[model samples]
Target: MFKILDKQELAESIIEYTIEARDIARHHHAGQFCIIRVHSHCERIPLSIAETNSQAGTITLVVQIAGHSTQELAQLEAGDSILDVVGPLGQPTKIGSPRRGIFVGGGVGVPAGSSMVRQMKQAGAQVLAIIGFRSKDLIIYEEKMRAVADELVVTTDDGSYGYHGLVTEPLQERLAAGEKYDVVITVGPVVMMRAVAEVTRPYGTHTIASLNPIMVDGTGMCGACRVTVGGETKFACVDGPEFDAHQVDFAELAQRLEIYRDEELRAHEAGPHECRLEQALKELG
Candidate 1:
């Protein structure tokens, strides 16, 4: 059983949990994720490892209560025990000798990118991070990203905060300014990552996007997370939650996110135990 050590409300419906998972945190690294199960009957869900401290034996998970499992997970308070917590799964980000790097994170991707930014900075890379949201009320972790990154740009579609546009704006400006980045990592909404790929295409920048598809199992066997990268199929779980953004098929990914659309909606309306983010947002409304 994983013990909940702390809980925080980041946004209206978003909750961050710090769990005492000694074994999991001890082996966790930046960019790794975990598959959480609320109980024996709960559906498996993948969540990013927002932060971890091996010495403290804790792992932090920032989750927007979107579905059933996540909604249930949110109601859990400190000292509550989770039925199962299975990870530090998938490969960790490779921040080799960080040249100049740009980290782009949108919405929930903000927290995930926060850890990666800190990790890359700790490795001696000058980090420039961009975080975006629909509006000011939805934004999170800008200051956290700024603390580690050398430069941080915040954007919102409605001009509610920071720049009034997508994260791609400043990214292009950097490119125009003759910045040569060793890597461009983006994690966010499907459309946002796709847009990132489009803008960086001509520049030949290596853009890595953290792929969040319909993953049944956090292993290669399920083949549920399979995606075409450079015309070849790869699983987002075992192969990557991160991939070459340039070669990724964003159209196919968008379709996959809708594959279970009806069922997901049905599940959402059924109860808070259906999906984490959606359910929580509904409850907030």
Candidate 2:
């Protein structure tokens, strides 16, 4: 069992957990994620490793309480043991000697891409990070991203704070202003990533997008995480969670993301599901 060493609420419904996963912490790289099971019989969910401390043998996971599984995870507290914490999975982001790079993230995606942004800066590349949220209240990881990036721009769709626009606006403005970047990496809602891709396509900027698909198993054995990149089938679990943005079929990806929408709604309406242990403890009490 992996112990939850610490926990913090980053934003409304967003929780960050520092887990004691020794080997995973030591081997983890930017862009890799972990599949966590809160308790036996609970469905597993994929979460990005926002940060890691190899010496401390811990990895950080930022989880947004979206559905049943994530809600169950949020119920866990520090010192609780997770039933399963399997990972260091997925390919690491390729930061191949870029002179300048732009990292775009939104909502929970901000923390998701924090490690990648930090790594890029450490590699001697000038990094500009653009992070967005629905409103000021939903913002997270501002200082974390700012500390590692050369420049940080925060946007909010409702004009509640920062740039008061979508993340793509700043990106488009920069590119249009003759600002050049060796690479642009985006992680967020599908529509946002697609928009960012379109903004950079005309400039021929090398853009990569991290994909979130329905994944089960996380080891490539379960074909659930398959996505279309450049018309070829690729599994996000093994082939990549990050792919060339221009070549990705965003329409198909957006459609696929809705596959379990109805079921999730029903599950949510039924209320949070507890594992057998929780029920047993309640019964005994």
Best by lDDT: 2
Worst 10 residues of 2 by lDDT: 276-285
What does candidate 2 score on TM?
A: 0.94
The TM-score of predicted model 1 comes to 0.92
lDDT of 1 by residue, 248-277 (tens): 999998987775555566676776444443
| Model 1 spans with C-alpha error above 4 angstroms | 270-285
lDDT of 1: 0.83
Worst 10 residues of 1 by lDDT: 273-282
Off-target runs (Cα >4 Å) in candidate 2 are: 270-285
lDDT of each: 0.83, 0.88
Q: Count the backbone clashes (under 3 Å) in each candidate.
A: 12, 0
- TM-scores, one per candidate: 0.92, 0.94
RMSD of each predicted structure: 4.8, 5.4
